[model samples]
Target: MEAVLYVLHGSRVKLACEQAISFIETCMEEIPVAIQEYCFLELADPTIEEAYARCVERGAATIIVIPVLLLTAVHAKEDIPNELARVSKQFPNVEMRYSRPIGVHGNMVEILMERLSETGKLIDKDSMVLLIGRGSSDPDVKRDLTTIAGFLKERAGIGRVDTCYLTAAKPGLEEALEIVKQSKYKKIYVVPYLLFTGILMNTIQKTIRKSLADQDKEFILCQYLGYHPLINSVLRQRVIEAGGGQDLVSRHA
Candidate 1:
């Protein structure tokens, strides 16, 4: 039977990894294809090679391998490609394809805009709005966050929106938060650029919450982006539309 392998980027939190898989499972319920799944690279278990091998062993002549990542960061581009190349060498006959990560799509724009709109309703236009991302060392990842923030700023009609990272590189969240505070705005909002729930999110929220105690109680901490109902259909259409090599595996969550 034909099989589609939705490969997750292993998470530090076991629950995060499991959540990613669960998101995909819900998406695949309607697709007629036989679905197989795996998580390799980073944390957790089952390396990509093992998953590819398993698919080949199961008589899957064509395996669609989707890398369930948010953006085209180093791990998504370098690590996944290197592993796929190695796997391709072993199973020369199994047609496999890799699509770009789901980033900056119209639907993603919708998600951000929706969040900002809802938040904007709670605050006055004079209040400075800050779009906080988890931040990544990868420049491309950072660019994605900035671009998304820019889009939301225009849609929400907010005068200002700034991007900040959590760790790695410079300009961490504290620096960004402080800058906004100096503006002496009545309130500030921080949005998580993350897809899954995990320790990084918890830590960031705690830091923000603690800092907010000194400020006006109106400080806003928006929720992390997750598997919303429309997201499953958005991911499905993304893979279906952004096609590459024949038999190339495309996965989304």
Candidate 2:
């Protein structure tokens, strides 16, 4: 039997974990597979080993592992793969395939734009967008985010879009905010490029609130990207490709 295993980057927040579970469960229902399971990469229940064992116990001969991540970072490149490799040794008889994260895509840009639009504020040439990422030591994280910022600039017809990180990269959130504060643009939109709500989301809200107190500029903090329908479509495409649906993958490629 064939199986699909969705790997999510777990969170310490209970609501964050619950949101992940809820989103994945909804996605599972749409996939035409009997043995579909989800596990966390860290900070949550059902480790990768536990989920892989369940698939094997349920008579799964082949398992396709999909990393539910926003961008290609160290967790997607190293940690998850390392864990999967360890479990694959035990399941020597079973064939396992790994899929890519939800990397740079047009759909992601649409999600960002929709998030900004939901603020009910006009996104005009005077509006500046501060695109924030979860930060990674990997250079690809910065590169990919910069690309997305450019896409957003064109998509929204904005004059400028800036990219920043929460940690491990420059300019940090504080530095980016200070720069934006000094800029002429008064209408600033801060968008968190994250999948779900957690400590990071809370921190962003708090930080923005603090910034608002001191600055005269309008700092509009948008919502995090959480289980949007476009994301469901993206994950479905990834699952299909990982499960040997090469024709569909090639179409996107």
Candidate 3:
């Protein structure tokens, strides 16, 4: 039988890792894969090696590793694949295939739109959107985020959409807040392009509340993208594609 291994970028926060595992469990309910398991990339238990072993012990001849990441960062591009390569050598008989990371999918845009609506702030032409990313050293990840911001602007009919980073990249959260403060836009909606709630999300919320408490501008902080139905669909599609056959093997190797 075929097995699906969902790999998430692990977090130091316990709840963050738990939430990711829980989301994968819920996804198993809808996915047709016979054997389903999950593991963290780092900072958590059941590393990729352990998860791969468990899948084999369960009699899974073929294992499909699907990354549950928002963008094509180092975790998706290098780390996960490198780990998988190491593990694959140990279990040569077991067929392993890796799927692409979820990057700027159409459904992801819908999730952002859904999050924006949750803020209860009207998105008019004058309203500006500050899309906050986790930030990456990878230029590809930054480029992908910029494209997503453009799509958000066009689809939501907002006056402007600016991309910012929580850390590591340019236009940090504070700098982005300053830009919003200077803009003529009456309302600024901040949307986190993240998968689950963690320390980062908490910090972002706290910072937003503190910075804009006395400001004249209205800043609406939206919720992070957590286990939404559209997100589930994207994950399910990744698994299906990974399980197609050996064609996916070369992509990761």
**Candidate 2 TM-score over all chains jointly:** 0.95
lDDT of 1 at 70: 69
What is the Cα-based TM-score of model 1? 0.86
Model 1 segments beyond 4 Å from truth?
116-121, 242-253
Give all TM-scores, in the order shown. 0.86, 0.95, 0.93
Task: State each model's CA lDDT, in order.
Answer: 0.71, 0.90, 0.86
What TM-score, to 2 decimals, does candidate 3 have? 0.93
Across residues 131-174, which tens digit of lDDT does each residue of candidate 3 receive?
99999898888899999999988888888999999878988999
Clashing pairs in model 2?
none
Clashing pairs in 3: none
lDDT of 1 at 129: 63
Error of 3 at 171 (Å): 1.4
Give the per-residue Cα lDDT of candidate 2 at 92: 99
